[model samples]
Target: MFDDATPVIRRRSPKSQRRRDGLIQFAHDFTSQNGEDGILRHIFEAVLPPNENGIRHCVDVGAWDGRHLSNTFSLLVGPKHESITIAHDQHNDGSWIGHHDSRSIWRGVLIEADPGKFRELQSLHEPLGNTCLNVAVSSNAVSESSLASILQKSTVQQTLPLDFDFLCIDVDGADYWLLHDVLTNTSYRPKVICIEFNPTMPNDLVYIPPCNDNLRHGASLAALVELAEMHNYLLVETTIYNAFFLPKHLYEQCFQDLVPDTSIEALHETTMVTSLYQLYDGTLKLWGCKKLLWHRLPIEEERFQMLPPSQRNFPFAPNITSTTTEISDPVVDISAYCQSQVTEPLHSRRECSSQLLEQLKSHGFALVHGTGISAQLCRDALRMTHLFLQEADESVRRSCMSIRDRARRGYSPINTENFASLIGEQGPNDLVRKFRIGSESSTESSLLQPNIWPAPSEHWDEETCDEFRSVVEAYYDAICIAANSIVQCICDGLLQEDEGLAASLDFLSSSNSQQSSNQRNGIPTTGLAHKTSILTLLGYQTGSRHTKKHHKKKRAVHPLVAAHTDVGVITVLLYDSGDCAVLQRQVSNSESDKGKFKDVVLPYPVPDDPIFVVNIADCLSALSHDTLPSTIHRVVPAEGSIPRNCLALFVGFDPDQELKLKEGKTVSYETWRKDRIAESQKVLRNRMSVSKS
Candidate 1:
């Protein structure tokens, strides 16, 4: 607080810096505070002087319940907290009880604008003898006076000292303004400050005052840095939401040993121990500071070990070098690369209830031994697929061609070799009919959209169309039923605790109250209609006897579908084709980050032992934070003249709800879906323009 001179940080060699960064990435010593609550521990441990004990004092603005997602929790009561302690017969919280003797002593003042949350916050810190205020905080003179008065009263009443050790400001609105006022008008200066930073704001160092509650509300990173400098603080670490800063004096003294030099070169370079981890349903985040040493715990060490050797290598070099032992007859074990983490699929739904939960956690996808999905129904569905593409009249097939803006829906025949190589045979041979099933509105309140049933054609026999509709619809319903169970299995896997599951289900149910029962149910249905789940009928024509074989036979012989990950949560593949391949990434030390793809044959579904192959997709991986692997798979051209017919179902999250992550970061499914669609359209437009030229 007394220092006017810039702090000097210790300088380390490049090799030493790299080694220190590696240790932090491997150890999980401190968890992510902004993303979870681990990063705060790193911040506190780094700034506070060694051997200093007992509450230095902290103030948390916009403190909700003082525990869940709180940045000051680690400093207030210590990290390892238990509700029930046998040694100390204390009230629920072990604040003044069992572990208080060895506890890192600390006290805090929690302020929340919401009356209800403030009450809960008070109850949570009741045993700690900390003050919890329910009044709103603002930069206005009246609000500033009231806030100053509260601080004055707390200091006198509790006989606590002034000049807080830590300050956490995180009100949803006017966060920047209130923080600015505190720095400029108050005599209090926190040794360390953890405040919310707006990610949506432009990175340029401009300060935008909050006037509308609807807009993203927080100070920009550059703006916060400027503000902290004005208050004699040095910006230390920037997490997903919060920015950590240290008083200049504290920075020069306590942090020099851990933090690297703050020179221009060190500031611009990303030599800090940074990490990108997906919080539970949260946005992917980068963690750690360049200057501060990043500490890793045992759990993170185990996580690194689980990675392929290439990823596990130190220095994180793109081209990693490793020695290999050659085998007499090398045979790539496909199972080793893409098989379920578990040994076997569940035999029944009951088994799915018990075992699939563990499998989803480990493998991300599982095979059900007995799904009860009728093989005959699937065959009939395949027959309908064949009739729509090959047997149907020319006008009937043309009628289903997608219109101007609805390319994702209706019928689309493969035209280019790229399309053919990705999902079907080259040329206009492959026909796909995409049907949306459920409610029509794709808003936050309603994720369901009415199904766009294919119109009956006059050229086709009316009786045959009716029969086709009946059979296909029945099969669709059956797939939904099985998929629902799969969805439940995923929910169980993703949300292990009952409370987490209940909260998710409650959100889903409340969001779709006006929609059908299926909509209310937490099912994976997204990526198409930007909300509605998709059911596609794939008809890949290898060739027929009457078809011309001369011009380009290479198109048919090449990989029918190129390697790609599914866009949705999970994909249910139902087909009798033996000519498909699952593309599993094979990482080599010599290869770049994106490893080469290895293809393995996808076996045909046995008639007697009918099994539907379900693969975890991109949406689920994002939702699950990569806990489940999103299987990358593709179809290969059939060997015979008969066309390969298959049905695929893509399920995802409800569009209306935003993925609530730690540190107030959120991602809207609908927004992400729209962006993906826009990107795809741009690619298609460029491809079409090139072809026309």
Candidate 2:
């Protein structure tokens, strides 16, 4: 109904002619609603006469629920108009954050992703040629060449030469990563670009000043932006919700059209009041032509007071002067820079949770927390991880020297299926190599496959390899992120010993950035960081190893011992990827089925149901946060089988550390077992041998 939304955008009035009042109203309406940066907001703004070239070629990244698409399209095609084919990632999705109906194109080809959901969604959108990928978007470390879709049926990739009058990219969280991996790497560059309003999105969320996930300095909003000008793009437009980049040709035409006739100057405030915010219908809107005013809500006002005046907005700075405080856009030394930022103290629990979640989603949930994992999720993560590690080239894993057990296949989970797929399609030797992934236990002297463990070897190198890896990786990442969720739940005073305890909000600061790199690289830090992350996330001050463990050489130190009390108050441990072993001594008489009853007891017997998920690694997080015992623990050595390599998250609690002599009642483990002292001496002697030998 409204096709004329583009041409007259900024055409000038002739010198001999006086402009009509309608033109003024039109420009005013355009600037007031649609904004000068060339975003399509409302129909009234789109209806404003365009010069010659109409709006064409658009891209919106982080297009949460396609709200921006709906709003922008309304300006071009009228509120109720249908859309036309615009080239985009055929499997792109925006449903998790919000929902928007597909207008122009087919129902949007995305992977149905599951046995059930895939079937359901496929049935629902079969009319749209079965758009919508059901498979999860994995971490983006992978390149297009390594796609897991090559052999998968029902998978369709978008072929280029796919012309589009408009383009929108709304891939959320991974904006920067996606920018580098996809848009910049691809041949497609549009007349306009719409980037999502991520906290770390390029222009606005460039670089949050290096703090522990806190918004201490808003530098994270703008990084290497000046360098972007070299990329044939400049930070020409910005909004609180989205940013726009105009091609040089579009810039000239816009200015030429607005020449002598319009009162606006070059990139001048267009009297547009909106920024990267939302439209009337709650869709995100970006950069305004007119400057928007602000109201500091009580919360905002308080935040403003907390921050220094200099850190606040520019009001508008045509050019930001380079000063001592001005962060130089140096080539970021990834290792050094990452370390420096992580060294800073953390923010409150809310800040930490928010930032971590953003990071997880940004990295396509690449990491797994050692603590706070549900048993089933943890098992699934482990199964997936083992597959990736086993399938990878042996040379790669050994060269990398598989550190602590966190990384599976030496890369993030998102890249797994593709790698597995890569190995799967290769020649026989390569296939045998990939399939041999957990076939032989390095721990065992025998070159024998363990029972019930050959499936990964059998399928890892098969044609459907990458697809399986993709499926497994999702489960792995979900558990890792979920671990943090559990931690957050606890720190907010949710993981309580008192079931009747009312919920309380405790604001805890951000702790250091604990990377997997930290763990695999060291034995001590693995256990320490895992423990500290949980406590830190729970609002504790275990910030930077406030306590130190010192070993005095040549000095006598005695083993600290205490008689068992009801397992004392609780402690928690988070695992990365390895296992933890808890050894206990029991007399021969403390027996179950003629075997030694465990000195260390499990809360419950292991479940036999195949679907049952019991992650021994996350056993620590499962313990109540209070009144748990301070059990003796140490890292299980990293020898293959003889040494028993495993991921262990331990929770130790001490209600009281005072001495108690168990004189009357037979000792717990000894109650049923016999020859307690002799057995104890034998176990201790064996441990001593391992320690010395």
Candidate 3:
């Protein structure tokens, strides 16, 4: 029934209609996007009535030519008078004061650092009752060009109110620092602040690049929000690149209805979707701008990555795609992977394949069996550990006592360690004697202390002590080799899975190589040396003095080693025990099985083939974004069981290697390790005090 030439009318919704009406009433564009100029005009009209005789002051840093992309230019020129040209002589000093004009009530200070731009700014603002400064504003209070110093040089300094009406900062670089200084050091607290922010950054990312005069790296909106809150300001609105903040008291009085939601997410949601993201394979995806706007460098570099290359894989991607769609690959069942047996020969590096990587990713452990580390070598190490513990006299034990402040590289007597306290559980002290060893020669000898070996005594001869030291050193070297091979295999597997990860890893490796070379050349590097990794020989003596003390307390079970996660990258454990002594906590969905500890069974060694159990430790788990879990395990012997011995090589990154955790905190490996150790010790001390009470 409709005519062929009839035009269809589209009805606007109530919300859209209101927006349209608003635009018609207040959409004046004076070099500002998103109607910022009109908004500011309305705000000023409401707060500072033009009818009053009071003179309102404004400050504009980085005011280019005083008009182009200027926030205060419209306010200076006023809404009524469109054309008014007047020539005025410049003052002898670098400052120019304009004649009073009846058309405008705002008196502003326009500052531009560039010499050429300052000339244009003076020519434009000198006739409009405004002050123009040619000096750059410094955030440092001590600097000669500081805002306070510069303001003192101007004629308007006497008239400028402590609580100024408006302040606009668009210096691009050091905007945050400048504002912070203005609020903290000086008495001036502007009623409204219009600051520039990097629109390309994510809403949650709180990044403030180092302040440099030559660099124009802008601060993030989130950082500005935090700074505003610190100074009793509430974020009211945001354009694409600028955020508007109002004093909390003023906002509460008049602007509550205007901005119902003052949160950054509500105001700038569209601009907050970051261009950078990560794929399931640890591949970074640059969705929008690939280059840094100010630095003119590619953002795909390793330094800009949210997480380290080793941690970018699935389940570890801090910023992933927004969609809920799964990857094309089949989903891996964690339970099946936990139960799967991944075994490789220690001698053959090629056998450490994807299967082992998968098992490590799921179950956090794998087994290496072969002639690379002969059965005889393991037996000899275990025998020496037992002999050293049993034969060492009190004097020898005291001489080798561990220096708690340094790298614990000596002897720790029985009943000294209570690892279960780390997980908030109180258990009997471990009935174990430990001897730790590190590289004999180290560049930083103070940090990595020298190993202390038992000298010739009544229990052992000089020749026997020499043989024991030789066996321990040989075992340490062999385990280090196996650990290096396993790490290389893991890196190779990750590279194979995702080629993007290889580039980042390569970049990191090249950086580390350069740092290592610098250290070798005595360049005074800050990173820790690679020789700081430790090897611990654990001897669980049955019916010992510590065990007797524990038995007298009538505990249900004898815990040789309490439940705790290892502190390094990976632990290569070689134990001489027929029974299943190590128990690992198997996390399950079933309510009844939850938190239960399951036995970790080791395969019987055949002839010359010795087996090494490799488990993921805390550092690797953190670096890998928990794609590999740090397995929580403990050593507890069965009733009527004989003594057991274990030689565990705890491999770690160079002490100086800095790691960024998932929560966006960066800390050195050594510091991280020391903190964990300190926490464990504190808990142990607390538990010990409680037990004594």
Candidate 4:
């Protein structure tokens, strides 16, 4: 089966200069032919032990142009080439094996369907004694026969533990089926597998048949993981559109405690960038794991620029270049400018209500200085968050992901990790630590879901685990108390006959009474009412390269949170770093100050003080009919290696409850909330559809 003629390659000097002018000479050689050279190198280094010597064979399916973006390039031309030998073998048993050479044998079979590319591949590797075939790999017996013939010729099957070193599958349309057939029907399984995944689709376990060329060209990570498990493999790493799987037996020896169990939580500990969507069949689809397309592919950059503000998948906000100087003279103390009221200690309980209301009505936001919240409470929450995310193994954190509770009410890793491989910038994992103080469901028909949590043993000792739970619960109670006081203050300031706020207060009081009564009477209850609020503990890591270079505001801005108004009634934010919370005055479209509001950067509060930035939300603003503007604010991502943390208490009411308003007006908060959420979801859906198209 071997071709008689030897093909020659056109090689250039390592330091050769391009003949641009044909006059003067410079001493810089061209970059390598392989665009994915570095990534492949890193992957091999991780899989292969440091100083061992043996034959390393690989199979490159869809091996177009051989060295161009070839996953097996490093094995052929890297600095370790001298240690490797190459040859070809045709045994008496009618079997064919790609040849091998010296100290460390390196040989590979490159399969290319396109005739021109196959010729190029043959020419590139013929001199090295490797094999290149012009054939399409498929689930059909004919396609597999080529591989079966070659595998039997080699002693690779006898090389137990590592049948072959690496296998790269990239057939574009039928990769999943091909890999499945190879693993299930044949004995040649590589120690390491690098397969292309569908970056445009969701991460659901969806597999498309090879004949379905009209659908997505690749399989989802879910599908791949299922296949891997069936074939005695485990996913170890994921690039933009590629997943790396190693033999299940080899993972423990290579990575060990580096990777936790294969839970979604463990996966997130490695990277936080994900593109999520839901298919019509009700299965959630996801794309982009570890590396986002924004970094992996250049084509995404062009598309990202074309997306509108509402449709764009920004980690935070856009148009942050608007300056504060245009809206107001830079105030040294933004807290003073906001005219915040001191409502802590409850001092008289009823005495400080008016001051809180006036400040809220005038500035749209205010700093509430109180004794209820302490540094220790904030630290406890942040410490637990860091311990779960940074200190624990990735798998431990992944174990906490609750697919059923998609609002992700516990330890959720939101989009925080950078597309480091693509963008050359890597940041710490950004975990959105969530804790619920009340029921998650709104209606009676819905079952109330308890908070999702990580397994205690996954991260800490039993003693520390008990303390973690206690401290978090204590902080939850403290924030709830502080937030309740602010709600009462709002009720006192805005309503003449505040029955709605009184009813809410009554509900809380009666629920506590019922719980106490139930415990006293030995009757079981859900503890709190069917409606409650949430406290979001966020770790905003340093800004990514895109935010740093593109989104710098007059004041620093975090991309994790962008220029948008809060969705709830009121957001009580505890800022832990620099003047991170920036607020802009709401200017009506008819006013001269219309667009000018974008310029104002709300000033920072006194550092290390127990100052809670209380900002009014859309619900209150909608109820007031723009009389009380919902301030537009954003958290500017901190720069450099310095990470920032914040605790925000979102005060909300029963969605089903109707609001009693001024002039005998009545409104259902649920209706308005649904409309807003629907509109945003529509925009995002449209964007995803258009992007895929």
lDDT of each: 0.52, 0.28, 0.65, 0.52
How do the residues 1-693 of candidate 2 rate in per-residue lDDT, one tens digit apiece?
Answer: 446643333335324332333122222121112232223331113322332333232332222223233323333322232343332232122211121222333223333224564564444344434234444333243533211221123333342222333344333333344344334444545444444333323322335233221222222224424324445544444334444444445545553343323221122222322335433322333443322132222222212122122112233334332222211111111111112334634434434434333322221111222232344443443344343443344443333222333121222221122211111111111001111111113342221222111123333455345544443334333322333333343333332324332221121112212335442212223211222121100001111122233556443221111112111112222222221122232222113422222322221111111111111121122232222212222221121111111122212111111211222232222221223334444665666678789
Residue lDDT tens for model 3, 1-693: 667666443434322112222212343455444456766776776443443555778999999887666777767764334453322222112111232234337888888899999999898888876888898887676787877676665475787878888999988777887788787777888888999988888777898867566566788999999988998999987777888898898888887766667887567754334355556655565555567665687664443444322122355434422323222122212211111224434333333446667867756777655325655567678767756764457566656776653236888888887777665567788777788887555556334677888788776789988988888887876666556556656555555565655533342333322333333223223221235668888776444333333545765565677877888878887765423244454542246654567665443222244556778888767666566777777777654333456788887766676777756677877898878778877877787789899
What CA root-mean-square deviation does each model show from the true structure? 28.1, 26.2, 26.4, 20.3
Q: TM-scores for all candidates? A: 0.39, 0.25, 0.43, 0.41
Better of 1 and 2 by TM-score: 1
Which pairs clash (backbone N, Cα, C closer than 3 Å) in model 3? Answer: 528-656
Over 49-138, each residue of candidate 1 has an lDDT whose tens digit, in order, gives 533545467788888877666666656654345662222221112332232224246777888888888888887786777777788765
Best by lDDT: 3
lDDT of model number 3: 0.65
Error of 1 at 9 (Å): 86
Best by TM-score: 3
Model 1, TM vs. native: 0.39
Which regions of candidate 3 deviate over 4 angstroms? Answer: 1-351, 391-396, 403-407, 441-447, 498-530, 544-555, 578-593, 604-607, 663-665, 677-693
